[model samples]
Target: MSTPDAVPVSLAEIARIAGVGRAAVSNWRRRHDSFPIRIGGTDVSPQFSLAEVEQWLRDNGKLTDVGGREFLWPRFEALGSRDESGLAVAEAARRMRSPRTRSSHPGLSDRARDLAIEAAQLGRREGPRETFEFLLQRWLETHVRQLSTTPAQLASLMTRIALAVRLGASEGGLTVLDPACGTGHLPAAAAQEYDGEDLAVLACERDPALAALASARLGFVAEDRELRTEVATADALRADPFAGVRADIALCNPPFNERDWGYEELATDQRWAHGLPPRTEPELAWVQHLVSRLRPGGAAVVVLPPAVASRKAGRRIRGSLLRTGTLRAVVALPPGSAQPHSVSLQLWVLRAAPDNPAAASPGQDALFVDATRFARPGVREPGPDWDALGSFVLSAVETLDRPDSDPPEGTVRVPLLDLLDDEVDVTPGRYTAASAEPSGVELAASWGDLGTLLADLAGHAQHLSKLGFDAGTLQTTATVGDLVKAGALTLRAGQQPAESATPPREGAVPLLTVPDLLMDGKPSGLLCADSAHAVAQEGDVVVAGVVRAYKAWVHEGPPMALGPQLYALRVDPEKLDAHFLAGCLRAPANGRQAGTHASSSSRVDIRRLQVLRLPLDKQAAYAETFRRLRDFETLLTRTDSLGKRLVSDVSDRLAAGGLTV
Candidate 1:
């Protein structure tokens, strides 16, 4: 069963095992590189090791119904009594130990992670739809974090979207559409809750790769033959994939921040009834597009950029839509719900109720939520958190159902009059008054006082500056190698996993990753705990050898440690200003030296770091700047902490039936 690639078995063997032709296997092989590669014997014949082929097949979509034991045992029996399959499995297990393999196939560690995510959806019974939804979610989730969403925020959004489908939307005959379906998670989520003979859904995506992926996921859903759903690959705006067709609901999360939408060409088109959307405002165009595809009274919940709520050009279109009464509720999302970026988002729930008065609720009385402060700590992407947003939206929608009447249980109601009185500001903060202040202002003040009382260690910064001296001349600046020669700093190599003595604790402290340093430099509060061991201590000057990055932080607490892969420069304070040492590390000449000293494998030599040349006083001044910046950041954190505690307290009370949002 072994092939040239390793433990027997080849791509041909896998094609034979799956009863598919070689072309099919080759196509999959070409598309996904992780498809097992054979050991180095080149051949005209497409080859694969049985172990690698089986692993790839299992990972992609082949052995789902079969439990792991069943999947492995049969292959073992089919092979030989000598248990070659066992050896292959063992080899694959060993491959898992490799960092490359681990990074490539993170899914292997916990195949059930998707299932666990689905378990969060309460009212929905687990079924094939749920399984497919979870699978598609995991697949789409792979790139959304990179495309825009943060990993943590993406997880929360997927969970909330799943719960929304399970709780609020009827699954019996649901049909979903996303006009600007990026990677198609919405339709995929719909396919999970309502993919049977009765339910059908379609997703329209413009990006070819995303459209293909959406097609694959939705086709995979309907591929079972019993399901009745499909994802269409096309521009939802220009060409309505579901044109001349009606949907039960048109759920979308369209692209925001787009300046131009092809409006001039579609001016005479029938979708824009309320008003013509300004060229600068594309959101209204999407709004019209979503409404046009929905059946009368059919609900469409779309996520929009904050500008759509109150931007000048957005106002007229928004007003017309409100006057027409299709606009339902506008739920303000916490910032940073999307990652690598932070812009406030709002959920616009519209229905094709051309005659419904609620849509035309007097004078722009849309339900506004001030969810800006509603976020939980820990890996909150770049903006406001929207982890619990769906629940809030669901609650608001339920309240809206009893329009003009008081809400029951967990709902807050504000008249549109009140909203207008607030100058048509759609931010939820415009409606809701500030909640109780921090419970421990006295403690905060005391801490502030303590910060003030801490004796200011006298430094030569003021004196040197007053004398018109260029502070960059303290040390006859040497390269990092020279510093190493002086024994002022050293590089500690990142240990291989096999060489690691300390196993990673689930949540001890963050182990900084290459990505954690994204966005120009390291984000102030980011830390990763994925690794077992880390290096760097208080007052350590560190540089990421792999990332070619540098950062200097005075670890205020012992918890502020860095990855071992990073080089820590322990400078003699009397000899060099640690801040200045960091600045030298950033110097172009020092960078060249460090690059020269870096290992062939890309690891930087710590000894080379100390060779850089820097003036002493300049180092001190830089250190002073770092200190002030850190202190200011600490104060900002305190202010945020107070806000977070306020929201948390309110959510707790609401959950306990003592308060409402």
Candidate 2:
């Protein structure tokens, strides 16, 4: 069936549905008198009636195979704010599922009702829960700018961790509570995981619109599987809708850095059983609130800012939490794992105080896990390595089972007393045994390995020195800009797209970034379908645009998306050798120029860097020599690292009487 006459679509959504760029949609709007006129939205991104736009596209033979859900998504968004769309959908869903119920949704438009019924029919055919999830996913993609929704993968991980904690406690028939559950992802994940089991999911969201959305999502899942779900629209901190109710498991990813989260009004609230939280530390308040909602020995897993583990302002509450045995484990996640993608975050697993407070020891050790490197590369959201993360969760469960067992690498058993020092820093990195000093046997082995590496290094150095080239006379120099003007190379910088842009799904082209160039000179950024900037070709020289330390590397991999803070230099083989250009780009003189330019703002203008002007044959000849020098330098670095380890190992072994000098 055709879209409703009343529903409108934004230009961006129209482009997406038509399998073309937004510019194409704009061109159509301006060039074709038959194109739909604007009905709503701002002048920059005006909306057009869906029926009119679809008719125009069909008339022009530009129509594509857009899905029913895809066609309705923009219309739903055009209804109003996300909350309005959510409410309309929720009412429609309720009516669709229970047609016999009294009609109270007088606000729902006739067009919205028709679209919702069509959407619900599609849902029923595709399995109601899956279809609803698809609609919700599309809605989330559009409102990503408006909502801080958790990534699906992260939500799954959080739910898995909560379940593991529940299993560790030998709990069944799970009752899960998410106090600050935005859109109810955590609770919904729990419902799915515990399918066919008697699971009760409860959640609270301060935003009424978000609460309605969450309620709709959880209600759909509950209806599909006959699970128990309850959601309320109330501030979880100031007016906890589920107060005095204790659950077996409580999961939360509360809002961070909320300076005025009703601190003055709720200062004397009883939920702060441990201690009052400072105005600056709202995460602590969330932790305590979630803890208060857990029954005795009930487990709660909370996503918190990394600073909470070490921030001095919250030190007293941290100490109280550690001393009271409420805090059980602290896990450090990789950067980009949570919102504020640049900052690495922490997950705190807490247990409610036992009924007899005296019986609960005040100094029990807590598990500290350093999974800081566990996230996979992502374009928009940090994609976690599920296998690694799952392994960590399982290992944590096993550790709880065997308290006396030695924790694995990246995991430690740190005493509460140790964490209660001056800093009261519970950062897992501080206490992890992964950084422990090597033993005598390990030291001796390192020494042995160093000797073998030294011999290999000497052989490579000898070979490099033997392939000698003549020291040429002083040559004329030209900046990269001159070479560009002479058709020797084309230099272009990568663009930095907005953070809200949708990341490419898995298996797309990988993106090369500055960090990747600096670390090992590889394309390590998340894959993206459209980079919206210059892409790196295999023969191109990718230079780090941020000149904190000048770096240049030949792009040897397949052509991929290029990220910000990088320059892609495509060389004309007939004019200049790529390797030679890379070598000159890495020269100290160019590095000095980069440093000078970067001194003001750390941004380097690569075009201004100087290079030695030489014939193609001369460039190739010098390139080979420079290549060998690079190999020599690599071996030298390895040799120096090994030598330091060897010396330290020998000294350590001698002190322990395990080896003779």
Tell me the whole-model lDDT of each prediction, alpha carbons only.
0.53, 0.75
**Candidate 1 lDDT score relative to the true structure:** 0.53
Backbone atom clashes (below 3 Å) for every candidate:
38, 0
- How well does each candidate superpose onto the true structure, as a TM-score? 0.49, 0.71
Expressed as tens digits, the lDDT of each residue in 549-655 for candidate 1 is 54434333454445345555676776777665665565545445556444434544445554335455656666665555455555556656665655675555556
lDDT of 2 by residue, 1-661 (tens): 2244577778877887786667677888889888877887788878788777777888898865545565667667767767667766666556546655556345567766676776677655556665566667777777777677676667777776666564324245668899888888888877876644677889999877677778878877776676788888888888887887888888889998889899899989988887899999999999999888887767788899888998888999988988877888888888777686777788898877666565443437888888877865533335566577768755864575366676777888877777888898998888774355577687778777778877877877787757745588677899888999989899888755323224567656777676655555545555556545678889899887666646776788887777776789999989989889899888766766755453734777787888888888788887887787787788788879878877775565567574545
Residue 487 C-alpha lDDT in model 1: 72
Candidate 1 stretches with Cα past 4 Å from truth are 1-172, 193-197, 206-210, 222-226, 233-235, 238-241, 255-265, 295-297, 334-336, 339-342, 352-364, 371-414, 418-509, 513-561, 568-661
Off by over 4 Å in 2: 1-12, 20-53, 92-96, 99-131, 167-172, 262-268, 353-363, 376-380, 433-626, 629-661
